[model samples]
Target: MMREILINLPIESHEVPNLRELVGWDGRHSDYPTLFERCNFWAGLRVEKNNELIAFGYVAGMGLQHGYMEDIIVHPQYQKKGIGQSLVKKLLQESERVGLEIVTLTYDSKHASFYNESGFKPCSGGLWRKKD
Candidate 1:
């Protein structure tokens, strides 16, 4: 059986540290100010039976031509059990509601197959640069 994940409203700053720690990949740990500036984004959180956050996904740029999905992470302990899929599905539905023409995301090659299964197409066009 699949465990239910709940997305509670009014997410707080206290959750940021835990979100940072739960991520398994290397990412810039966003502070409260950064998170606040991006609060227009939405996050879906998976809670354990005892209400601990076990997984999450961040979605931004609603109603735009290019909406972005970022920080979709499942705590290692709860991975490979459809939590990620459920979260993505919810985000996609939300995007469709907001008139987004396309939803895009960037992920590691190792997870390419997973995203493919979730209906994300692999594209070969883009210029990316990181600032130091």
Candidate 2:
């Protein structure tokens, strides 16, 4: 049987704990509060059976005309299942609706293929970093 995977966006703080379990990101438990407060942007998650979070992603920055995709995650069991692509397409569409000029992200080389397949290209001249 094919399992259902749904992308639910902008989940509330209370939902973070479950996502933590799904993704096993211990840092998220400690850092998400401050991160969320600073970002003040909508986040997204993929839910299966309308209950469990199978994947998650978020956007940051107020310059809606040129935003960035901050995070995208799919549960280990759910990778290579097309869930990530659906999530990305939705993100791009939402960004475009607000007149976004570009949606950018820096992927680890190992994961570059996934993003490239989703229509993302390398920036020949650009810099990105995580602020502590």
Best by TM-score: 1
* TM-scores for all predictions: 0.78, 0.72
**Per-residue lDDT for 1-132 in model 1, tens only?**
334544433456656556657664544555554754663355556464656666666666634676888777777777888888888887777677668778888888999988998889999867679998
What lDDT tens digits, residue by residue, belong to model 2 across residues 1-132?
A: 234333334455656655656666553566555656665254355454555566666566785577788667776777787878877877777677667778888778998888999889987757768999
lDDT of 1: 0.68
Q: Rate the local accuracy (lDDT) of all candidates.
A: 0.68, 0.66
Q: What residue runs in model 2 are displaced by over 4 Å at the alpha carbon?
A: 1-10, 17-26, 33-50, 125-132
Query: What is the TM-score (0 to 1) of candidate 1?
Result: 0.78
Question: Which pairs of residues have clashing backbones in candidate 1?
Answer: none
Q: After superposition, how far is residue 91 of candidate 1 from its true place, in Å?
A: 0.3
- Candidate 2 accuracy as lDDT: 0.66
